[model samples]
Target: MDGLGFTVDQMAEAERRGRLFGLAGDVLQWSGPPIHTVQSAADELGLSAEEVARVWALLGLTVTGPDVAALSQADVDALATWVALKAVVGQDGAYGLLRVVGTAMARLAEAESTMIRAGMPDIQMTHTHDELATAQAYRAIAEFVPGSGT
Candidate 1:
């Protein structure tokens, strides 16, 4: 049987990686936690679909169909963070963050995707989420402080 672009060795490596990541078989067939559709997430966050889309779009995300399952837990957290940011920085500052941060992250993801498609090594799972978050917090602070990391 023809295997298209995937050789037996490549398929084996994929299986090994999937097993290591606790993922079963295909991404489509994987039994995993529930992610949210745009509409459902809006309902959960008590926001209008238009509002959610506006914010999510600022982050370079476009959800065309309401039933499209696209959002993860981090996206949910982002919505909550938006609420907190509004309380702290008011409306304009919060939206500004959505535009700046979203664009930056989307660009970063594009770069990462390009490297990965060019066969960069698999992503390392060295830092726990907590450790990564703490490191990111420090890095953001250092970037903000003039001549700190320079």
Candidate 2:
């Protein structure tokens, strides 16, 4: 599957990298598999679908349709946090805080990824594209980073 100026080999390499990195998802505290749809998450959290979508959009996430199972446990926790904050600060205040936090977190993630990529060569000096080596390097790096407790 080649598109967007990426040759088939490039796409294949990306897929390999993604598969290797996916093994580090738990260590990285990345979201788990999708466990809820937008409507389900809203219903479980005692929120309207629109409210959930709005919060997601404010956090720089794509707002999926009501029936799409695009939300994970981490996503649900975030929505729950939004609900709690909204109760204390009202919707607008919660939105403002979410916007600030989201932007900051996004920037931090970009910086971290850049740093990690820069360090990967030293981390796995011999087997650059070896999946197991790459995954191990990622897990080691993630272990050193602080957890977000999401």
How close is every model to the real structure, measured as TM-score?
Answer: 0.52, 0.67
Q: Supply the global lDDT for candidate 1.
A: 0.58
Model 1 weakest lDDT span, ten residues long: 22-31
What C-alpha lDDT values do all the predictions have? Answer: 0.58, 0.71
The clash numbers for all candidates, in the given order, read 0, 0
Best by lDDT: 2
Q: What C-alpha lDDT, on a 0 to 100 scale, does residue 90 get in candidate 2?
A: 92
Please give the distance, in angstroms, between residue 15's alpha carbon in candidate 1 and its true position after superposition: 17
Residue 15 of model 2 has an lDDT of 65
Candidate 2 per-residue lDDT, tens place, 1-150, comes to 222243566446546755533345333554766778889999999988888888888888784577878799888997897798799999789889989988987888788778877767634535465655665676677765656432
Give the per-residue lDDT of model 1 (tens digit) for 94-144. 899889988887676576446543542222224333433433333333333
